[model samples]
Structure formats: structure tokens, C-alpha cells
Target chain A: MSHGYQAVGWSPFKKRYDLVLGGLLAGYLALFSLATLLLRPEITAETLLIRAFGTAALLLLHAVLAIGPLARLDGRFLPLLYNRRHLGVTMFLAALVHGALATFQFHALGDAPPLVSLLASNTRLDSLSQFPFQQLGLAALLILFLMAATSHDFWLAQLTAPVWKALHMGVYLAYALIVAHVALGALQDERSPLLAGALGAGVVAIAGLHLAAGRREAALDRERRAAGADGFVEVCGVDEIAEGRARVVTLGGERVAVFRYEGRLSALSNVCRHQNGPLGEGRIVDGCVTCPWHGYQYLPASGASPPPFSERVPTFRVRVVDRRVFVDPRPLPAGTPVAPAVVSESGGGG
Target chain B: MTPLDVATWIVRLAGAYAAAGLLFALLFLFVLRGVDRIDPSARAGSRGFRWIVLPGVAALWPLLLRRWLAGASEPPEESNAHRRAAAGGRG
Candidate 1:
């Protein structure tokens, strides 16, 4: 972190990552173009550009969407998550090329402007098979453009992390629109079933990965939830929590991070105020609970960021009895200071 | 009015909005010193940074304006209690 903004804080690793990504994208386009030329020599240059770029963009989008779930399911995929914004921006550029070429070829030099033609050319909105597919594609491109444009830390910080995240969730809407665009437009004309089958498979793969990850997280939550007496829920034993770390427990539908630090225990909402990051997944650094995604820090007991930073998360009352940790289900307001439960000498042997 | 006329009007209005947005982004970058809102590591004031975020600022000026006005205020309270209770308190 510096005092001012640079174009990018590119590290050796990030540079390497971009190099690999560029090589892969270039190789894919070249191979796809060469294959198409040999296979369909009669095809016009415009059609070839449209098909090649469109397919590449679609594939890149699928890869981008899959990255989050894939990273969650396996630690090995975490490296891909580091520079995902670059990949997204590249994908948007590909989509832009495809859209521009398609518009010029089909809609330019006509009586109406391209945007108007895109919307009005196919007025068959009522027909499912012949719906105005160009409109769907245009709408999807707009969303992608918005996302790509804001894919920087400046926007993330200015918009605040939560608002920024919510805005970027427009990716899902874009994905749906693109799916409809392809199903109604290209699939209607193409004789081959390969493209259609691939689209179906891509959707299924993305959905299946998310479902599996959700199930795994749910199961972990179930295992951690054990109700104690008097509205208190048993998180793990004190022994289960590592020093400077936390045991995340889901009780009454709320995720709480029960931290063990300096012979004291405190429970706070697991969500980071900065980005809704999993605070429980992070460890205490410099005497504060550091968020793993971004280095936003908060005191364990108060759930408040250190002085001069106003961010806060909800705090919960926690108790330790006979080596076991129990947390009150009700959460206090953000920045509320609850007393930390000291670890007794007898129970602190772990 | 004919459908063509309506279409032409819509296109013209969209163009006007885009031009206004570009102007706003430039104002924010230079006059407002909006680059400070960016993370410190990225606040290098590089030409590349301006080039990259220009399109985003143009597209999302309304949202950015709201945030800039809010100015370090506490985050809006989340109403996830119902969902948390439904999920058995697992957020």
C-alpha cells in the first residue's frame, strides 16, 4: 500500500501471469481462425471474425465465472484468482471486438443507425425462437462494459466494497442475456449441434461446481453447530482454536469468528466491513484481525478498525467453560466492545 | 411519430448522455482529485490508470456520485437477520 495511485502495482508474478494469459488468448484465436479458414474457405472475413471472437469471448467468460467456485473447491486454483480482473478486462475487449465487427457488417451503411437497427431490426419479441437476439447481446455487452470499466481498486474503494460487489454481480445478468443471445441468434442458424451442446455443457458445469461448493460449505456449518444451554451455541473447544486464529461457527444463521488471542477469546461477525471477506479465514496480524482478501483490520473485542479508520463489524459475547467455547447468538451493533473471555490456566493447556 | 423518428431520438439522447459522462469523468479526475479514493498502492497518478478507469467513471457516474457524497459514512446496516435465522445462523 502506497500513499498514491500508480497505473498498476505489477509484481513479477503478476507480469508472468499476464504473459501466460496473453499467450493463451493469442494461441486460441490463431488456432481457431486457422481451423475455420481451412474448414470453411467459402466463409466471408466478417463472418469468420464474428464467429472466432464471439466463441473466444464466450469461453473466456465461462473460465472467469468458474474461477471463484473452482478456487473455493481447491486451493491450487487460488493463483488464478489473484489477477482475475485482468482476465475479465481482456474478455471484455474480445467481446467488444466481436460486437463492433458484427454491428459494422450487419447494421452499418443502412438507413437506420446501428444501435437503432440492433433494437428494431428483429421486432419478433413475442416469438421465442426468433426473438430480437441482437438486443440481448447488446444489453449483455453494456453490462460487461460496466464491469470491465470498474474492474479496478479505485472503483472498489470509492464505491465501498459491498456496493461495488453488488454492482459487479450484474455479471450474472450479463451471462443470462448472453446465453439467450446465443440460443436465439446463432444456434437458430447453425446446422451443427456442436456449438449448442457446448453451451449446454458450459452452463451445466458452472451450475454443478457452485452447487458442490455450496453443499460442502453447508456440511461444514452443520458440523460446527452444537447448541448449548441458554441461547448460547457451542462453537469448538478452546483447544480447537489456534492462537492468533479463529474457529468460525454458524449459529442461528449467522457466521461468527471465535478468536483465540493472547489467552483471551472474542467472537465477532465473520464478514469483513471492507469487502464481505471471510474474516475467520484470516489470522491476527499486528494485534488486529486482518481480512484475508484485503488487509482491512479490526480489533477482536470491539469489532472496530484501528483508530483513524471507521470500519466496523458486529460483535458477539463469548464465554469459555471447561475448555469449550460458547457464543451468544445475538450480535451487538457494529463497533460495540464486548469483554473478551480469558482462558483459564486449567483450560489453556492446549 | 414514425418508429424511425423515435429510434433516431433515442440514439441522439444516448450520444448526448455519453458525451456528458466523459466530461464528468475528466472533471472528477482533475478538479475533484478523485484519484485519492483509490487504494494507495494504485494511487500512482499514472497515465495508464487514468486511461483504464476513464470508461468506468463515464458509465457509472451516478453510483460514484452517491458514494462520493456519502463520504466515509458508516456502511448501511445489513438486514440478513431473517436469512441468517433461516440458515440456522450461519453467515
Candidate 2:
């Protein structure tokens, strides 16, 4: 039997039906539970199922949001990135259930259908604690619905990458609204300190992860600027690099790696395209620079060719003037990464 | 079957289905970890957290009351046999 091990990579395929059905089931279950709770029906086996599902779904949403920063912080968690859409859609469905049950029980009874009641109910908008958290849930659900609908590659292809990315950013807005919904609706009535603390912790953890990532990115930017060849006044001797050793230099606003081999020096873009790994920290292995993180190798001479993969980094022209290496700030074409470009004692004398 | 028998069967069926759903959900909790492993992109960690923490506490709760009132004992008999065998071996 052929072990049909599907090559595990980012699945380009969208799970439209799973999201759709899951959303419907969650919405119905929530409405049913809310209706019974408001009516004060005897606590039956059905009530137990509803409570468990609601609790589980709420926890899952928090887990899903945490996965994004967790993955970015560590590459091992990249697996979560590939299936992020599934988690998001599933959580949306769960929240929908809670919303639906709520609408049916609280809003529907003596008026138009539950959906109409939700739309028409504007009486509680003025009050702080009395604000219809259901409306907030509705708004959040609408945003999630839009996101879940467009999560497929088909929709992604229809919407340009920029538009798709912009649309997906609505998740932050949805999350904010959901927080308000819970604070006003659930916590207001329940007054459970444990639940309130859990919510607070979730918000803090998610925000902290993003803030930490932003700080790291800012630091990387600083390092990139300092390492640029032009950032350093022509160092006393550009020829300071020992054979096979790479020197980090700054030129203009870009970081470049200057390496000496066979009495010649070459400059290459110091940033590894994969996660912006530090090319300076990497060592030359068989004439190829290997990234320390995932072992993505690039030819130091041309900055290309780790075959079956076709990505190129920019290279710069370097000239030695009285042992001082001067580099032209203009970047070479990405594919024209010339490995081991001839370095000379006189600027551009090669 | 009588109407009462049919009614009883329906109730039993519902209970069985609910139990099945619970069992499936528990198995899903474990299987999710498997799915997470098979498709590493699915979940974060191993699926045994339920067995390690939830099952022990939840399953033991009702058992505690059952044994408290009835003095239910079985493992003691098995252990007593082992103790007797050890003592006999020494004697």
C-alpha cells in the first residue's frame, strides 16, 4: 500500500464547507442554549452539551489567536500558520452558535424572527453595561463571516494580495468587538472574576506577543542600517577580511557582506531572504553560505543556486582603494548574484 | 413491542447517541493530536492532556461516592493474593 503521505506544506486548498457547516451548527446550538437558559428550562442533558461546546469553542478561539505570534516567534510553530484559516473559521462558527442562541431567546419571542429582532433592537445602545452585546457579537460575526468566506485561494486570487491582506486585517477589529461583547454581555451578568481574569489574560498575552515582535523588528532594522557598507566611513583597510572569513560592512542604508577568497573580495546582501536571517553569522560550507536557522544555502559568490529552490539575493560591486574597500551603492539585479567577484587593491581595479 | 417498549428504546437510543457523541468527542480530542501530528499544521501539541488531567478527575468523581457508600473493593483482593503469595514464599 502506497503510504499516501501527502507532502505536508501550506495547503492552498480552502475548506469552504467545513467553515460553512461549522458556522451553522455553532449558531443554532448557541441560540438553543440561550433560549432555554432565559426560559429557565430544567437543566437537562442537552444543556450540558451546549455548555461544554460553548466553553470549548471559546477556549479554542483564544488558542487560535495565540498561534499567530507563537508561530512567528519560533519557526517550529510555522505549522500553525499553514492551517490558521481553519482555526479562524472554526472559532467563528463557535461564536456564531453563542450569538444565535442568544438572539432567539432574548430578542425573538414576542416579535419578528430572531434575525430581524437582532437587527431592529436598538434600545440598549445608550447604556454602558446594558449595551446589547449581541449587537457587538453580530458585528464581530459579520467580520468573521467575511473573512471565513474569503479564506479560500479562489477568493484570494479574485482579490489582489494587498486587498486580501487589508480585508484580513479586519480580524483585529472583530477581536476588539468580541472583547467588548464579552465584557458587557457575559461578564456583566455572570460577574465571575475567574472568567474576567481569563479574558484579561488572553488579551494581554496576544498584545504582548505582537508588541515583542514589533520590538524585535525595530532592532533588526537598526542592525541592518549599522551594517550597511556606507554607514561605516571607509574602514582603514577593506582588505582586513581573512581568507574565507566574511566582514560585515554598511553601505548607504543597506547591509552588505564583504568576503575574501582567492585574493579577491566580494560584497553580498547580508540579509537572508528566508526570515531575514543574518548572513554574517553563517559560515561558508563548500563555497555556499548556509543559513544557521533552516540551512537555506546560497552561493556566496553569486548569492544564488541551492537548486530545486530558485531565489536570489542582491550583490554589490566592491573595489579596494589603498586597502580601503569602496562599494557602489547601486544593487545588482537580484538574479545576478556573482559569487566571489574579483576584489582588487585599487578601487574597481579587478 | 409495546408502545412503552418503543418509547424506552428511543430514549435509550438518544442516550446511546449522546454517549457515542461524548466518546467520539473524547476520541476526537485524542485523534486531534493524531491529526495534528499527521498534518503538523493542524494543532500545537500532543492530545493526551484530557487523559492525564480531565478523565482522571471526572471519571473518579462519581466513583468516589459509589465506593464510599457501597465499600466497593476489587483491587484489594488482587493485591491480597500477591501479599499471600509473598508471605507463603517466605514461610
Candidate 3:
């Protein structure tokens, strides 16, 4: 939301969020380490720390993955979604600590390099029970490293938002690798039903939440409005949309948000330019349509961000006739300014 | 080849790719060209920003290199369902 990029874009809210997260992370690691020590005094410090960080990372990864579906299902969790990159980067750091320590402990003394030893030492492909799982963990770490490196808006702007998003979608692949790494490595070694149960529960919970959100989205897409002659679709009653708000309707395989403000109706593509956020879900602020995800603003008339910002979304011609809002299914070029259809002008077939 | 041998080759190849990426990033960030031409916002990005972006540059060096070599001065236009629909208006 700025013309220029800063190192970290540090803000008051980000500072507070990071502080709270730091406190929680430290507390969790301390508690895990204490519990492990009390339960097994025979364990060495390195082993204890590795397990503590590894479990912490796994738990954090689940939280990171769950936050998306949770936010989609409920707006209350949107704050978590806002700074999820921080959560993901924190998870990667925790995982890096676990990986570095484990490598040092397990392979440092070998004649080959630590990475070489890690890859060459474990060759138990003969049995599923003894398969090499460190490779899986390492692979996941590499993906996370790449993701964390490119998490900033600099990359988003450089690579284009869609490409950046596609790259970050590697998170799902990393998640799968991590699940396999744990199920085959730690669970095999520990042989603890409780551990197994926790893993299963996490996977199920994440999957279930995603499916629930997907169902809700599918329902929205199903309510596509029937278009009439002149390529205009009658979406909803003008009274249905509150002032400074929008009613999103699917038309011609695209979602358009018809917004009402100051007795005038305007239509814009539902997608925001920054992150493809739902502009329909956001309300007008300071006479501008503000995005719900990151507050990226666009003018309802031109579907363009105000001066100093060049981003734009497609604007559709819209009018209200007989108190029913009708929008043209074909969108105008982005940033094209069209006179808003006033309520009184509707009688003239505006 | 055995699974282990296959894995070792993959790891070695990836490692070499990363090493090359890191070296290329160092030159690209410092000597090759200014980011202002590629991206205006990165005109005077901070040291911390450059350090943080090293891994990303290492990972996507090939793409960046191609863009840089081709003298691409702006980011590509994003295409999506809405944009595709809008493109129909042009046709």
C-alpha cells in the first residue's frame, strides 16, 4: 500500500504482533523442554532442544495452515491472516534450528560433509519402516527457505502478484513433505500412539476446515444471476445493499461488485489488485472502496486506486431500473471512467 | 540406480544450482544493475532488505536473470479470471 518499499515495513501493529508471538514461542519452547527433561532425564541437551524446536515448528506450521481456512470461515480470524507471512517465517526459523542441530548431532563427525553424510548415510530403501525421512525434512526446509526469502512485497511486485502467489503455493507441497517426515521418522522412533493421534488430528482438522470454506465459496458461486437482453444481469434489489456497501453477484463467469453510495450505483470487479482480495467484502471509507484484506483502496467510479497509486480493476456499467440493480456482464477497460447511474436517472433507462 | 543414489544426485544438483544463484545474486544486487530499472520501488532498498532477499534472488535467479537480460523494465501484467473476461471486451 505504498509507493516505495522498506526493509521490513515495521509498524506499530506489526511490532506488537511480533512481540506477542515472540513471548508465546519462548514460553512454548521452555515448557516443552522442561516437560521432556522431567520425563526423560537420560536425554542429552542437544536431543531435548532438537525435539522441542521440531515439535514447536510442526505445531506452528499447523497453526499457519489452519489460519487461512479459519479466516475464510470467520472474519474474526482476519487479523491472523493479515500477517501470516510473519507466522510462516517464524515457523521456518524454528524448523531451521531443528534441522541444523539434528544435522550437526547426527552427521558432523562423519568424513563426508554434513549434507552429504545426511543424504548418503541413510540408504534403508529396502523397508518402509526404515525409509530415509531426513531427506523429506530437508526438502521441506528448502521450500520453506525459498518461500520465506520471497515473502516480501518486493518479490510480489517484481514477480507479479499471481506468479508470486503460485510460488508461495509451494507451502502445500512443503506441508505434505513435513507430514511424511514426521509420520515416518519421529513416530517410528517414538512409537507413541499419542503422537500418532496428534498428527492425524492436525491433518484432519486442516482438511476439514478447508472443505468447509470451499463449500461456502461454492454456494456463493452457485447463485449466478440470470442475464437478460442487452447483456445486463439483474442481480439484486437496490434496497438489498446498504449505503457505502456492495452486493457481489456472479455474472458471465465473473464476479462483479455493485456498490451503492450517495444515491449512485457503480460496479467494479470483485477482485482487488494487490492480493485479489474481496473488495465486495470491504466497505467504503473516506469516499473510497477499501479492500477488506489490506485496505487497498479503489474509486467506485473508475475502479482505479486514487492518485499516487496506479492499480486498477475492471469497471462494469451498472444502473438501477425499477429499484432493481442491473450490471453489464462485459466489463469496461480497467480505469475507464463511467458516469455513475443515479437513482433518479434510472427512469430514463440508465 | 538405487533410491539413495538418485537422491544424492538430486541433492547435489540442487546444491550446485543454489550456489550459482547465490553468486549471481551478489553480483546482480551490487554491480550488475540498479533495481530501479527493474522495479522503481526498490530504488534505494535498505541493506536489511537486500540481505533478506538474498535467498529469494538465489532461488529465482534464472527468472530474474532472463528478465534482466531482456531489458524488461516493468513487471508483467497479471492475468486472472476477471482480466480474462475483460480481455473479451477488447476482442
Candidate 4:
């Protein structure tokens, strides 16, 4: 019942932003359409469709960028991360509509085979000011298409995580393209107050969240450094540590754990590889330290773990001098296999 | 609507429905699962921000449609029991 690491498949069943947005948009459009139909009675169908599709496309773009920071700031916001793909695809669909409608109204009827017109209209590739803005939209659309195409797990599996991840980083590029696309296309022409404010808000929100996340992470790192030991520290007599148990020790800026396991004494980096939980607070099982936060296990000897769950922590050199344990602050390369410092039953020399 | 207008409207309507439906269904299924896999707490539409909905619908619908057309499911997580057994039954 197994195929060689065939990437696990997902079929999620959960709430989504689609309902909330869909309802909002649908409600907005329905009201607009009905009002236009009743009150004005002379609005062109094409114009009506154009505005609706354009608004939808822009809204979708805004959603795609906000999900990350929102999740970082709040635990309850995690659901947004799961369905971000859906959010992205939804935005693409809206953009597709905008593209198709724009294509039909402006390019299709009077043009020579829409493709030629699209290529020709933005005729000035060289001039910055005179450059055809539609081309930017075209570029953005292409990037979105590429992202959408590779969104599936099938493609993701074929591409592996790193390649898939790298490819998807293209979103940043696509976002830039869209920004230029909008600046050139919409801002240049209509300069609509509502549209400009909405766009600006989206960009600001994304930038703010990223900045906040960075600052928070940096603060945590600073705190960890302050708690860690800068140089050697002397601890209890060699026999004081029980086998297979870890003791937390604070040395200057570093918080290091001295672990005794399998008749071997070793030192491990206090920070857990997962979520930076204090590893020294964890319990030892089978010569490995199991993190208290998420139970990520690391071998005390080398800080390495079995395959598919491979992770490592920095190991320190330990020595017993004059019957007391001394730890050198200089850390060994994380995960490098090293022998534990052992004490003899004879105790210290007379 | 003129015949040409009708044709355009039909395409537009279809595209919109397709986009929205695909987004909702896809979000309901695949991306939701991805959220669960990466971090089970991630749910869609939790923020209630009007802007977040745009990407939700845009990216999700097409993904669902593509999955249906391509016959692919969302990616799944490694079951703890299965992984433990594979890791030789150690806790």
C-alpha cells in the first residue's frame, strides 16, 4: 500500500475565507447590479462587468499578501495559512476575469488576433514613461499562472520541497510586477480615490506585518544570546549528575544544559530546534533529548536524529578536571558525533 | 443584452462562477488540509478582513478545478503512529 515516498496527498475539510469574501463580493455586486439595473438603466453591460471584475482582481491580490503576518501574530489566525493557496487561486481567477474582459472589450473586436494586439499595444519596451502598462499586467498574469500551475501537490512532489519552494518565491516577483502593473495601468488613468486607498492599504499592511515579525524574532534571538554561557563554567562533582537526566545551567548570555545519559556526560544547546523551546527543560529517552514543546528528539552524542526527521543542535566539549566538570564554551559543529565525558568510579586523585 | 453582449456576459458569468466556485471548493478541501499539515490551527477566513478574501477565492478555486481536472488530492501529513512504527516503535 506504499509507493516510494509518493508525497502525501491532502484533502482538507475546513472553514475558508472564500465564504466570507464570496458573500461580501457577491452581496456588493448583487446590490450594484440591481441598483444599476433599476436606477440608471443606461449603464453599459461591458462597463458594469469591467468595474466588477477589476475590483474583484484587486481585492484578491490584497488577500494573498496578508495571510502570513496575520498567522505569525495570532495563533487563532493559523487557519488563514492553510487556505492561503485557495486565497491565491481565487485572486488568480479574479485576475483572469479582468484579463479576459479587458481582452474582449478592448482587444478582441477591433484587433488583429488579440495576441498580436497585446504584443503590439505595449509597443514601447524601451521607454519607461511611455511603456505600455498592459504589458505589466500581462507579466503579472504570467507569474500568477506559473504559480497556479505549480500549486498542486503533484507538481510540488515532482519538484521536491526546495525546488517547489524556490519556484513559489516567485510570488514576490509577481507581487512587484502587479504593483508596477497597477501603478502604470490604473493609477495612471483613473486615479480613483477608493481604488488608490485600497491598494495603498494592502501594501502597507503586508510591509508592516513582515517588519513586526522580523523585530520579534530578533528580540528572541537577543534574549537567547544573553542567557548563554560565554566561556567555560564549572558544575557539580562528576558523580552528582544522574545517568539519563539533564540539568539546566545558566552561564552569562547562554542557557546550556548538561545531560548525563547512558553513562556518558554531554552538553547540548539549550534552544530546541522546533520553536526554540528550552531544550534543557526536556526529558531524555533512549540516549536522546526529547524537546518539551513538540517532542523533537535529538541524540545527545551528536544531536542528530534519524532520517526524515533529521535535526541537530550545537554540542559542547566537556571535561572533568580536578573532580569537577568543566565545559568549554566554544560549541562543536552541530550534529558532529562526539564522545560523552565519562567519570571513573575511583573519584578524584588524592 | 445584444447577441455579442450575451456571449460576453455568458463568458464573464461562467468565468466568475468558475473562479468563485473553484476557490471555495478548493479552499474547503486542499488548502485547508495544507493548513492542517503545516499547522492545524490555520483556517481560512478567520481574520474577517475583506482583503484576505480576494486571494482566497482567486487562488483556491483554480486549484480545486485543476485538482479535479488533474485528479490530484491535497498533500497529507505523516501519521504519528505510522511514523513511529517506521522509526522502530520508539516514543
Candidate with best lDDT:
3
DockQ winner: 3
All candidates: TM-score: 0.83, 0.50, 0.94, 0.51
Kindly list the per-residue Cα lDDT of model 2 for residues A1-350, writing each as its tens digit: 01112222222333553454467556756775776577666766444453545554566667777776676577576545546666777777666675666665666585454555565555567798788677687888778877765554323322433456678889889889888977887688674497789889989998998888678646654743222545334432655677766777555455667767666776667666543445654567777776543355777667774664554566666666566665654556554655444656445434
- The digit string of per-residue lDDT tens for model 4 on A66-148 reads 66666556646655665566667777777888788877887887635564466565566677667677767877887787676
Give the lDDT of residue A291 in candidate 2: 59
**Model 4: docking quality category:** incorrect
C-alpha local distance difference test of each model: 0.80, 0.57, 0.85, 0.60
Relative to the unseen true structure, what is the Cα RMSD of model 2? 22.3
Q: Score the docking of each candidate (DockQ).
A: 0.32, 0.01, 0.55, 0.03
Clash statistics: count for each candidate:
18, 20, 0, 39
Per-residue lDDT value at A221 in model 4:
46
Candidate 3 deviant stretches above 4 angstroms: A344-350, B1-11
Q: Per-prediction TM-score, chain A only?
A: 0.85, 0.59, 0.95, 0.60
- What is the TM-score (0 to 1) of chain A in model 4? 0.60
Model 2 / residue A278 / CA error / Å: 12
What tens-digit string does per-residue lDDT give for candidate 3 at B2-87?
65566568778989999999898888776664455677666666767777787888888998888888887776667777687777
